[model samples]
Target: MTPHMNTRRAAALAAVAAMVVVGVQTGTANARPAAPDDGSSASPRTSSPAFSSASARTAAIKSAQTDASSTAGSLGLGGKEKLIARDVIKDAKGTVHTRYERTYAGLPVIGGDLVTHIASNGKLKGVTKATDARISVPSTTAKIKTAAAARKVIWAGSGKPVLAFESVKTGVQKDGTPSRRHIITDATTGKTLHSYEAVETAGVGNSQYSGKVDLSTTASGSGFELTDGDRGGHKTYDLNQGESGTGDLVTDDDNTWGDGTGNDRQTAAVDAHYGAAKTWDFYKTALGRDGIAGDGKAAYSRVHYGDAYVNAFWDDSCFCMTYGDGADNKSALTGLDVAGHEMSHGLTASTANLDYVGESGGLNEATSDIFGTAVEFFADNATDVGDYLIGEKIDINGDGSPLRYMDQPSKDGGSADYWDSSVGDLDVHYSSGVANHFFYLLAEGSGAKTINGVDYDSPTSDGSTVTGIGRDKAIQIWYKALSEYMTSSTDYAAARTATEKAATDLYGADSAELKAVDAAWSGVNVK
Candidate 1:
């Protein structure tokens, strides 16, 4: 799995941002009308007890905001600090998590966001802040144009090409990179105020799994380099059991590659390359996204990472994907869905930039899983048909079981089938079950079903059968919500709003698609 930050850095950040909420009093179930059991409810009954009353929730949020503002000084906030409540997640247990944005001296502080966990008795249990530094900037002057700065970033090729403005607290990022170095650019001057790494690196050659695939090769003096001149000059490298260098650029005189077996090292490369190409096509053709960043640029892939390495990851630092040969170096972990899942991490980073922790982190993982499944379906390969199971081809569990089941995520020991207050406590991978289940219910509805020879029996939280809006509509709604409506701090409640908004935008306010979106969230207990 691709972690949002390096393991050590992430742990350090977590320590700084940790919050604890103790003594939660469980509340009684507050139910409304239920969806029709005929699997054709035009408008389903809302199942979110916490958010059922809009006015009450809004009042609670206002109270939480006032409480947060009153304790600003105690929380280490400056005099001019303002807290804007972004979301309020309340559990049936009466515990509340209030997410907020901080503004200092009337300017938004990029990393000054925090979450306040309140006990059922209205006692402030703890607070989690991304950064505790005071917000202060020397100046907002710029000597470089925004376009030029972005161009410089692209030319440097150290990371993806994107720019923003943020005040520097310390002089370095968690990774020890220089921070707050870019000058602020005026709209007329085309200068931006801040810069962050946008590219994420992590992938296949004529893939062993995808059979023959189109390769973008450049002619070298000796023969040909495994570089795709067409797809933003993307390339694939063999790590050769070594941990670091970009290995060698695969080359061939005849341009015929791989023998579909691990004995021939190039077979894994073929799978990876083909997977990358197909993933690119999935985004472009299905969702109108140009590339991982929607910038028409390509990312590179590294295979044969370590001895018997059983995992793959997308590293934003190098803007590349890395894969390990599983078990005895026989499983290359570069299947179509695997490639799509890894690459979608880059997309999630560039787009929603969902915080890789708690519920948002689960959404991030589920986003990758959703797109991975979509990519598999888009390919329509005879060898590997699309299914709702994640990592079905990788055999990561060593027992022939898939890593996750979207239809009923609880089928896996770790995943949760429905949303709950404690869902956020689980690992992001397991917490992702809520969103995956929601997507499955949205696309295929509730009940026993079979898709591409795979059987699925999805149940609803309130025993209400749901009628699907079809996978095509479901994907469209999810993609629009992810790319346009969702933000870095979006959680399950906000996700419900985003998907509803997306469906309304794409299929009209009174359309069945919108109804389906609402029903799907309700089915997952998100409401």
Candidate 2:
């Protein structure tokens, strides 16, 4: 599976637009502090001009709306085209960034959202959109009933339930699935306007991270299949050494599977099954989420994808997770955290739906990392003790170095330790450092520390000391913010606002949780 896909590309453009939008919105085009060259300091200062009166806020909002409207027109949108402002940020200097949802002819376009960047002097810089395609439908009438369309969707997936109906212009394909095609059934005609795979499936498998684990299996007429009767009927398939085909399901006579060694291919299947179960339990038990999609449905897993594929991914198209045998097939990418990381992608899609670009894109990747780390801690497996380092067991780097370091994200040599205007230019994985560092600070604070026998040293941008709010509280705040407050266009500043609101909702408005949320963002140079 390719880590850098269309999702990342789309997000990159969005990030660039968001950065421009943020610079203008916060009126911080001039006041925004630059990140340290060495990535050692988090001392980026943001000037907050007080808007004490309601009239001031109203004026700011109106100014942003006007700017967005003008920019929309410049982008060739007609007077009938509506740009509904979703979010507006006005910095102390009067610069504005307006996030908008576009409507063409009274119909909502899926990828028509954009961020408008306006300078304090009202100069239009540019606009960023998910897609530039013109949105138009032949007719609004549908020849199919909602129930019948829903039935057709279920039939397409062979039983996967319908999620929702979305309006989309361009049907982008991913992983051989029509990811953006929505089953839009016309109310008047009941006809299927456009149909695509709504259920996204990515493949994932198991490895040696959790050691031996108990698996749920069903007894078929011939023998026991790899399907799990419990846990949403999740099943594991063997891909053998091929890269494409979904291999046969492992079957056994006695219902017992795997010998705890690679000699038995089913051994990896056992690990994959166990890891999926554990991840499900973690989400449900800790966060009150039922499953990856919070729909009480289970996603399948594919093991041994390709010969030494060295990667795993959660593909929304297939609505499943796929894993590969790392390096010479001796190592499988199916660690507990890996499982959690891949599965969390599904959760992110269902929840925040954070576009994989800029700061929002970084947050998208970090969400998976955060949950992956949480899952590791949740499992408390002795063989794979929880640590802030990501992808430690699989040895992807070939030098035994972890893929990322939460304590000091820059330690990986590519990730940013603090947020900078240029951070959006980096790959989503590397840009994710800012949020990973923020999470570490929120959970473990700044300075040197040791966790699960691993050494770590985290620093702040402004050099202000931070006291931890504990991982449990930190995760709760982040999750609540992601699920409730965050949107597809959320950037660093918006994230700060979201977390503050989450903390207020969880604790009182005047609670320390809110304070910690602020301090943690500051530590990561988000402010």
Candidate 3:
């Protein structure tokens, strides 16, 4: 078949797994939704699992937090609310938006300041009146003495806290991006932050942030502390600018850049760039693995795909990654989690090579869900804090509900909480729900727990028996099985055998690790 015909047929077969094909315009506004197809896996996976079986469905699993209840969401969020704040900036057709968010009431709501400027040459001609000229945070708010201190709020705060508008530097570069460098010093404390808007809105070839230089509290007053600027340049914005109380102060080097011109591929590159680095860092530091395949090779990513390719993905053929700019927002399929998910597929491919067809498919699907969640927790982006929710940024359903729920995968129609013989016949994404739920059960256990104010009470079909092994250990065992034991065509029964062996390798055959793995899988009604 032709490439297009192959894609159609593959997508159809992938429907056995709910793979996301993202072939439309997916940007800030006017982007298309994931076209109607098989409900598929709870989300996309790197590739299919080895073999699917009714036996894998019998294998069991384990399972978090709200806007105000991030790490632990069991409490009433301590009054912390959910904020779905978004900023829309349109230069006639294209928009430059910066998202700021916070929680209010119980449900996640949207609120924040996005300054749409009518400038000529990096000089601010005007903003949409919402630009606060004063720092919106309180003086009593803890002053950031270190990047980590500031990062706490960055991951959860609405946006930057602009103390005051210092000066808008202007000039002209031969290119048409932007001819400006924004340098500002907080009047209250005299900390400095600089912003550079590229002159070419179409797409800057490839500039990166070097390092984060602390320009705050220095006697020189203009001294900078670069963090890591070897490949890319960097920018910052204070987070206390617009919020009910204290927020983050930060800036972007080229936040308002990257038009969907043919050259917009750089967008995906940046996504992959940051994503692969962070994922590598997290695995190396947290899990002690080298790369996706347990080797220290650079995983790749592809961005600015076809016209408005609405989805981001990872394929076995190309060891790298890929992303798409939504028709409406450039941040559509290219969110951090999407990048991580695509990359996780590579990890799965090199490790398990699970078939994308049946219950093994669900195991394959959940494999991505589990690691993608871990990746978000790893990067810890200030604005997009890690949560167990999938596709929380990309509003594929637009119902405000994220695409998939780890604690409960069935939140989106067609997902199963427990595996059965018929699961493989369902869409992979949907069918995979059973395994995703099993993974959650293994990690977090079964119960109606509240995370970030979102209430999730997982139920068991065969409630007569169940146990919780916890997420961290579960991840270790799964990764070990995938990397050291599994092959491309291993079936569901083999998954149970490999995982059981993994638990034993780490925790001794008679230890709790093996027992827990067995119990967790059993809790999910797998065996």
Candidate topping TM-score: 1
**Which residue segments of model 3 deviate by more than 4 Å?**
1-272, 327-331, 464-467
Model 1 global lDDT (CA atoms, 0 to 1): 0.69
Judged by whole-model lDDT over C-alpha atoms, candidate 3 comes out at: 0.48
What are the per-residue Cα lDDT tens digits for candidate 2 across 1-527?
22323554443432111110111011111121121111112221111222456686677667667766666778787665677777665533344656788765565654567777677787876666656655444443444445433322111122221222334433434323334444554444454444544333322233366765566765443345677655767888888876455678876665567776666687778777877888888877767665776545688888877666666766654567667676678677777777888788778777777877778878888888899899999888888889998888777777887878899988888899999899987867778889999999988899998888998888999998888878877887888888878987788889899988888877778977688889989999898
Give candidate 1's error at residue 458 in angstroms: 1.3
What are the runs in model 1 whose C-alpha is more than 4 Å off?
1-9, 12-206
lDDT of 3 by residue, 465-489 (tens): 3455655677777777776677655
Off by over 4 Å in 2: 1-207
Ranking by TM-score: 1, 2, 3
Residue 37 C-alpha lDDT in model 1:
8
Estimate, for each residue in 465-527, the C-alpha lDDT of model 1 and write its tens digit: 999977777888888888778987888999999999988877789988899889989999996
What's the candidate order when arranged by decreasing lDDT?
1, 2, 3
Q: What is the TM-score of each candidate against the true structure?
A: 0.63, 0.62, 0.53
Top-lDDT structure, candidate number: 1
lDDT (C-alpha) at residue 62 in model 2: 73
**Model 2, residue 332: what's the lDDT?**
75
2 versus 3: better lDDT goes to? 2
